[model samples]
Structure formats: structure tokens, C-alpha cells
Target: MRLTIPLLAAALGLCAAPAFAADGKQLYLDNCAACHQPTGKGIDGAFPALAASKVVQGDPKEPIIRVLKGRGGMPAFSTELTDLEIAKVLTYARVTWGNKGKPVQPTQVTALRVGAKGPTVKPALAH
Candidate 1:
């Protein structure tokens, strides 16, 4: 009976997809879907479509850095999100929308953020 429970648990694990405390898909929905749209097609003339976008499909650093720094109309997430959260969302984007791209590791995000260009927070006003 000692081996039975262990074997049963091991077998159950195989049947399930790896779970995360916060799933990548859900993270994308919460953060990106509002602008990008659930379909990833995005709003025309407003938000750019992530679906099959060459940028998203290109280097992982490009998207990761864009998210961290914020380009043009996009707001920066450097302070709002963690490295792992950024990685998960970027990975979800790159892998989804039928775009062929490599997965972005959390370490890569950390590496790119070694010295952020600006202060992470705004200075409080002096009375």
C-alpha cells in the first residue's frame, strides 16, 4: 500500500497540464486583452494587433523591453509588473496568435532590467 499512493499521485500529475499560481493566458487577458482584444487582433488605428505581428514574432527582447519601458502610446510596466509576470505574458503572446517565436525566460527580463533608464517611482512633492 505504501507504493500505491505514490504511484497514483504520479500518474495523476501526468494527466494535468502544468499549473501556475497565475496562468499566463489569464495574465494576458487581464493586462493586454483590454487593448489588444481577446482575439489578439487589436483595435484598428488605436492598439496594434498582436496577431501575427512581426515585432512580437521577432526577438523576445524587443517585446520584453517594450513592455518594461513602454514605447510611444504604450505605458511602461516596469514598476507595475514583476519580471516573471512580464515573461509569462510575453511568452503567451509570442506563442499564441499563430506567431512562431521562442519562449521568454524570467531571467531574461531580469537581465534586461539591470539598470532601468529612469527612477521606478515619482518623487513626492515637498510642501
Candidate 2:
């Protein structure tokens, strides 16, 4: 979810960047709500729930990289989503559904985007 500001802007097709996390709700509805659900509880085993997910909280970098690179059944959204949009979506997911990970910053996401090579598969649980 957490993409860099540059990536978010690219996703929105916007060049002008905004300060602070933008509308996370809007970002979710636009991209993830369909699969993740409005409540963040994903379908049974199809798209794992974000609520209290260790993957979501354990290492925010992984999810951000996933969104950027995609894996398995997930399509690569790196081209479609801008960095900022990714950041907002990750921030929203992290805070919602009892997830306690610190909000992902655009910069962190950007770092992952640059460093990550292939799909980032996490363990069943974040340790």
C-alpha cells in the first residue's frame, strides 16, 4: 500500500503533490476496497484480511513492495498507482482494523520501490 510521493502522484496521474496523507478512504475505495472490503476484512483466503494482519504491521515495507511489484494472483500496480496514493492506502490499512503499525511514509515506500527486486512474500505471520 505504501508508495512514495512520486509513485502516488504517478498513480493519480497528478504531477502536483499534496502535503500530509491525502484522503486514505478515497484511495482505498478507488483501488483496494473491492478486494480488501470496506471494513478491511478481505474475502476468505482470497485476499487476506488487513485487520490485525501481521503482514500489515510487522513490516510495512513488504506490503508497499508488494503493491509496487505485485505477486502470484495480484497484478502489478506499480504502473497504475502513483507513489502518494500507495502511501495513503497503506496508512489507511495500517490504522484501520486494529492494525497498529506506524503509518507508512511516502519516503519509506519510495525506498522499498527502489530496493525491492521481486515479489515480497511474507511468512504466515509477522514475527
Candidate 3:
């Protein structure tokens, strides 16, 4: 049987709360581990390694924007995950795998969400 967050949490005697209340590690395992792997080494060229990744370890906004924008094969989590969940997952990614970075907060995610813009279309030039 595949071990999921709730199952792992129950095994460890952790509470089975909603994703909003779940910890960063759990969120990461549930949502990102498939691609990024538990070791954060990722799947070579398919999925970039999160360990020591410049985007993951650099400014918080970088990861946040990527998560929200859906770069390459990475799906956009802006609609799927709550601000809190995104913050926790980003924080978890930043701090784990020997990476050193500041923790992201929901407020920061919210600010970015508010300021984020959809794709823009350029006006057609006269033919």
C-alpha cells in the first residue's frame, strides 16, 4: 500500500487534520515527493533537483512565483493549494536537503497572489 500523509501521520501518532493544518513535511510528501523525491534529488532532467536549487534557496519570491505560475512540467498550485499550504511547502523545501533559507509565510504568499497577474496579450500590429 502506498503510504500517504495521513497514514504516515497516524503511524507517527500525528493528528489527521486538513492540509491547512498539516506540517510542511507532510504537505511536501503528499504533493511534491513524487517528482522531487523524498531526498529532494528529483528525477534528473525530468524534474530539477530541489536540493541546493538556486530557485528554492534564493529569495522566497522565486519559489513562490514558480509554484503559482507553473513552470515547465510543474503544475500551478495557486488554485489547488491554500496560501498557508504553499507557504509551508515552500518553507519546507527551502529548509530541507541541506538548503539554508528563510521560512515563507502565508501573508507573503497572499501578497504575491494579490499582485500576481495573468497572461497578457499584445495588441495586434497593423497588417
Candidate 4:
């Protein structure tokens, strides 16, 4: 009957909820694993290891800023990831690889995004 159909739809919706939830680890792997490595230990002399990194362990704002504005060689993610995605990925990194930092929230990311400047694009020197 109508009640049975509604109940079934509710059950199906609950089952599909996990699928809609963001997977932070997967996001990190897709975006950061290449440089940070699966284990979070970076390549010596090249990329700095993220495991127990000061930046990761420090205030969430540090990593948020870094992600939005690329450092020496790392690419900025401001254009690539939504605020929620950045928050999730930062939260994942903070909790993993022996790091004990607090989880980052989307609201925090949004605040940082509002105040953060975009990555600097250095102009080429005139010949």
C-alpha cells in the first residue's frame, strides 16, 4: 500500500546516505598522495613529509591557508576544491599518520576562504 511504499523509500534513502557522504581519505589520495605519499612520508629532499608536520599539527588555519595558497612548489587547491572538500581533506590529514590536530569544519574553511588571498602569480621579468 502507500505506507509500505513510503517505508521502502525511506529505507532505500538511508542505505544510500553513505554513498552521498564525502570520503576524505579518497580525496587525499586523489589530490595529495602523489606528493605527500600514501604513508604521509614525503620524498626526501623533495616534498616535505606530512607525518607529524608542524603545519599539520598547528592551528587549522595554517593548513587551510597553505591549501588555498600554494607554497614553493605545491599547487593551490582554491579553484579545484569546494570549501567542504578542503575541510574534509584537512580533517582527514590532521587525524591520520599519527597527527593529533583537531578536525576542520566547512564553516572554518569558508571563513578562511573569505579572508585568504589567492596564490600569487609572479609576472615574468622583462627582457
Candidate 5:
């Protein structure tokens, strides 16, 4: 039996597709790890610790925005990373390092990327 071109193309497409979360992890290691650290424990007072971070534990929006636009001390990843890439990194942080928060969806990140005027305010952590 001979493989058709269309069938071959479809198979290649599936094989070449990017795993978003896995890609995001790589991005985090390369771009975010220096400060956030591999274990997600950031340098003291320079970068906030990601483990059980209030920013990551609650709403995914604010953190997603930070990843895209960056914060006071953090560099903006908007020009550095694609929207999908930002979503993946944020999702990885949300779930890693003993943090039990939900994942940040790519669609949610994409929406925020589109509508953000500046950094969106997140709710304060409860005592």
C-alpha cells in the first residue's frame, strides 16, 4: 500500500505540533529561571518566590499579564515571547513547585494580551 501526499502531510502535522506546556517549561527555564529559579524560589526581594505565590495561586489573569507585559522589576516578555509561549510559562509556574493553583489557559492569556491597557490589578492576598 502506498501513502497518499495528503495522508503524509496530516501525519507530519500531528508529529510536528508543539506541546504547549512542555514548550512553556523550556521557555521558563531559559528566560525565567535565572530569577524565578528552577524550584521557583526567586532570589530574596529581587524576584518574588513563585512557590505558593499569591500572584500565581489565585487568578491566572494578573500573573499572565505580568508575564506578557512584565512588572516593576521584571522584563517585559511581550516582544520576547509569543502569546502561546507566555501562556505555557505561566501555566508551568502555576502548577509547579508545590503550588496547587489551576493552570492558565492559552485563550485566557491571549484575551488579556489583546485588551490590556497596562498592568491589570490583582486582588490582594488574604491573611
Candidate 6:
């Protein structure tokens, strides 16, 4: 019975992205876990860890650009993920595993998209 659900989803092409668009962990699982691991502890010497990394918790643009443009061995997700998805995934990483970073909004991701065309993203208000 449980198996049938997965099989049905697979057969109907209902097992990806859209179904989990707002879920950062799922998005990470689908797009990043292979290299970054489920716990955000990436394989040493291969992929960097997100658990307590300064980069992940630092300027959001650095990671945003990396996700969009890819760096070193990482693959670019700009073509596959929407701005909101990227923001969710990044926000998940930033807030998870004890790291202290600001939430990344979809507008931030949209702002950094290469050749992206749309309304300009306004700066966040000071708290």
C-alpha cells in the first residue's frame, strides 16, 4: 500500500519540486543532499559543510551567487530552481545546525539572477 503511493507519484510525474516547493529540507534533499548530506555535513575534502560554516551564515549573496552560478565543483541551480525555492533552501541552511544568519528572501535570489528580467528588488528595512 505504501509502495503504491510512490509508484503512483512516479508514474504520474508527481514526485518532484512543485509538491515540495515550500519545504527547504525537501528541496535540499532533492537538490543538495547527495553532496551536502541530510545533516548539512558535507563530505570532507569534497563538499563543504553547512552545519557551522561561516560562508553559509555570512553574506547571503555569496551563497546565492554560488547556487545560481555554481563554483568549483558545485552545479548551477539557476536553471532548475525558482527564486523562492533557492531562498527557502538557503534560509533553511542558514537557520539550521546552530548557524546564525539572516533569512534569504526570494527577492534577494531574484536580484542576483543572471540576465533576470523583472521588477528590481528593494533593500530590506532596518529592524
User: Among these predicted structures, which one has the highest TM-score?
Assistant: 1
lDDT of 5 by residue, 1-127 (tens): 8889999977764443335446668888999999989889999978889988998888888897787777888987766766666767777787678777665656687788777665443322221
Candidates in order, TM-scores: namely: 0.75, 0.71, 0.74, 0.74, 0.73, 0.72
Error of 4 at 58 (Å): 1.4
What lDDT does each candidate get? 0.74, 0.71, 0.76, 0.77, 0.73, 0.76
Clashes of each: 0, 9, 0, 0, 0, 0
Residue 84 CA displacement from its true place in model 1, Å:
0.5
Residue-level error in angstroms, candidate 4, position 3: 34
**What tens-digit string does per-residue lDDT give for candidate 4 at 24-66?**
7888899999999989998999898988998997898989888
lDDT of 5: 0.73
Each model's Cα RMSD: 8.2, 11.0, 12.7, 9.9, 9.9, 12.4
Model 5 steric clash total = 0
Candidate 4 deviant stretches above 4 angstroms: 1-22, 119-127
lDDT of 1 at 57: 83
lDDT of 5 at 57: 82
Q: Candidate 3, which segments miss by more than 4 Å at Cα?
A: 1-22, 118-127
lDDT of 1 by residue, 8-124 (tens): 867664332123213568988988899999888999999999989999989877898888888878888887778877777787787687877666667788878765575482221
Pitting candidate 2 against candidate 3, the one with the higher TM-score is 3
Task: Predict model 2's lDDT versus the native.
Answer: 0.71
